[model samples]
Target: MTEMTYRQALHDTLREELLRDENVMLIGEEIGIFDGSYKITAGLLKEFGARRVRDAPISEEGFTGAAMLGLRPVVEIMTINFSLLALDQIVNHAAKIHGMFGGQLGVPMVIRTPGGGGQQLGASHSQNIELYYAFVPGMKVVAPSTPADAKALLMASIRDDDPVLFLENLALYNTKGDVPDHVEPAEIGKAKVTRTGKDLTLIGYSRMALVAQQVADRLAESEGLDIEVVDLRSLRPLDRDTVIESVKKTNAAVVLEDDWLTYGIGAEVAASISDGAFDYLDAPVRRVAMAEVPLPYAKPLETAALPSIDDVVNAVHETLDAVGRRR
Candidate 1:
């Protein structure tokens, strides 16, 4: 295994896929000359040339619709905040084409974008709007926290014969982790058990999954609590079975998300536990989510609005306390 940053892992995977498949091409604003907003496509233009590394105008809807018709196009929307501009194409056409045409046609395209707050891009630019795409039935959403999973999941998404929304967290770009030397594509709808515990289950995806790990370590050291951490790698085809099984074993749960609380991904997780493990649960399912407001531009406000390690730790403690399991 080789240690690499999350951004480098994504870049390497894209480069590997582009070389491996002739049909796979990239499309996005400033992806060519600018190397992408986050440099995920840094040197692709030079290697693949203009034909494969194509750039588009600032028309998300237009280009997204056009890319959907092409052969295995991986389009980057700059950021999830900007993805709102392409919602009509994403929700109405790309998502519904296969079903609308009775499976005769499929939009085998991947929409890659970063979300979550940390750099203080203000309310307009900094927001975890993954719930928008995750709510849609036709779109497949996956958010990987580690460099290894990032490469594997992206490889899988590019090959899938359906529309996929690859959600990246802005805060995770610089984070480094060990990536496999011979990486394999990860299954799209699976949750990974990162840590084992019996006191409570802490579930999260993307950035929150990383945070959950941190919380688990703290709880283990400070409170002598055995907290299990489940990373929800894929959001759309959510691995409810894994979540339910973990909750059943732990008998308690606390869902952490970078998005807002109401109607967020946590709500679905909590509901799934209630449906499948209601009798097994020893306490109410809890959630830790961003403040339900436009993420503020100021540093302090943004930090407060976004969910943190402390917030997750507190939620876990509260859930354990509710079940009288706190040490």
Candidate 2:
């Protein structure tokens, strides 16, 4: 095992994959000389040279569509907000190529971009619009909250024979965790139960997944609650069974998300729980999410607009109260 920051894990994994596969290459604006906005590709340009680690013009649509015909391309959009500019290529081309050609061809591409608030980047740059791509049928969206998952999932996304939207929440970049020395590629459509308990389940993805664990720990220590936590690592495939099973065992649930509450990912999860485990539920499912407004630039306003530990804790408490399960 190796302890490293999330940025380091992604950097090392990208380097490793580039070395392992001759056909694998990277594409995106400023990825070559600038080392990427997040520096995940730092030194990669020097090591692999421009052909493999090519920098691109400031055109998301143009560069995103430049995936090599028979090669795996790891494209990085400067930020998730900028991915909107490339939606045509992402949704119409990369996603539909395989089915559009009746399975003769496929787009083995990975689009990596970061999203999330708390950096005070304002609404335009700090939005979590993953649902836009995840809404499409052909894209696989995976958001990793830790360094280990970041490494494993990236490896899997690169090798998979489909377009994968690899979401790297901005807040997790500097966070550190231990990664396996020889990690296997993660199964793309699976959800991981990071914590197991008998009380109500706390479910989330990406940044919220990490927040769920922290909230679960705090509740365990303070309220003497045994809360189960499910990390929805893959948003699109969304392992409903895992979420359903956890809610069944706990008889209640509280969902957390970095996106706004209206029709957000949490709504889908709440629906899945209701569909598969309605009989087991003791109370209405609760959700804690970002305020339904364009995020403000002020740090305090941005912090308030985004979901927080207090919001999650309050939701958990309310759910437990409704079920008469609070200790």
Candidate 3:
């Protein structure tokens, strides 16, 4: 086991996957010569040559569309906000092609982008848009939390037959974790139970999972609350079985998402848990998410707009209160 930064883990995964699969190719802005904006594709251009790891111009929509023509293209948009500029290609061509063409055509493409607001990148660049791509029917939106998840799911995403939107939180790039050298790809739609408990379940994705762990620790230390934490790694094609299974055991839930509260991934998971695990529920399904609005540029206001440790802690307390399980 070796500790590696989140960005290095992803870069290693891409390099490893490309070496493993001959069909895997990459195309995006600054990916080859510039070594990617975050250096996630660093050194690939030198090793694999320009054929496999090629760079594109400023056209996010155009090059991305061209890259998804059939090959398993790993197109890395500089930022998630920039992906909206290429929405037409992702939605119409890459996403809709497989199902639309009666399985004749394939869209084994992975479009990776950075998101979330804690970096003070302002409203446009820092917003979490995981739910936006999750809303699309044919796309698999993956927002991995740990270095392991980032590495494993990226390889999985590259190999997926459907279009997979891999959202890497910009703030998570420098975060370090122990990564296994002989790790295999994890399934896209499966949810992992990060921390096991009998009291309540805290569901989160991406960087929010780190915050969830911190929130879980405080609950266990101070309130003696044992919380089951689920990392909803794949937002779309959500692992309903995993979440429903947890809700069945705990009977209480608090979903923590970094996106807006109105129609965030938390809302979807909450609704599903209610539908599938209704009889087991002892308290109302509580959701702690970002405030619904454009992210503020000011540090304090930006921090306020983003989901925090306090929100998760308070939500857990409220959930326990509702269930008469507060200690």
- List the candidates' TM-scores in order: 0.98, 0.99, 0.97
lDDT of 2 by residue, 44-96 (tens): 99999998998998898988875538889999999999999999999988889
Tens digits of per-residue lDDT, candidate 1, 185-266, equal 9999999999999899999999999999999998899989998999999999999999999999999999999998999999
lDDT of 3 by residue, 1-327 (tens): 889999989999998889998889889999999999899998999999998998998988888875435568899899999998999999978889888889888788899999888877888898787777899899999989889889899988988888899999988999999999788889999999999999999998898888888898888998898988999899888999999999899999999888888877888999999899999999999998888889999999998878889988888888888878987
- Consecutive 10-residue window with the lowest summed lDDT within model 3: 63-72
1 or 2, which is superior by lDDT? 2
Residue 243's C-alpha lDDT in candidate 1? 96
| Index of the highest-TM-score prediction | 2
Task: Supply candidate 2's per-residue lDDT for 159.
Answer: 98
In terms of lDDT, the best-performing candidate is 2
Task: Quantify all predictions' global Cα lDDT against the true fold.
Answer: 0.92, 0.93, 0.88
Cα-based RMSD of the predictions, in order? 1.0, 0.8, 1.3
Model 1 segments more than 4 A misplaced = 67-70
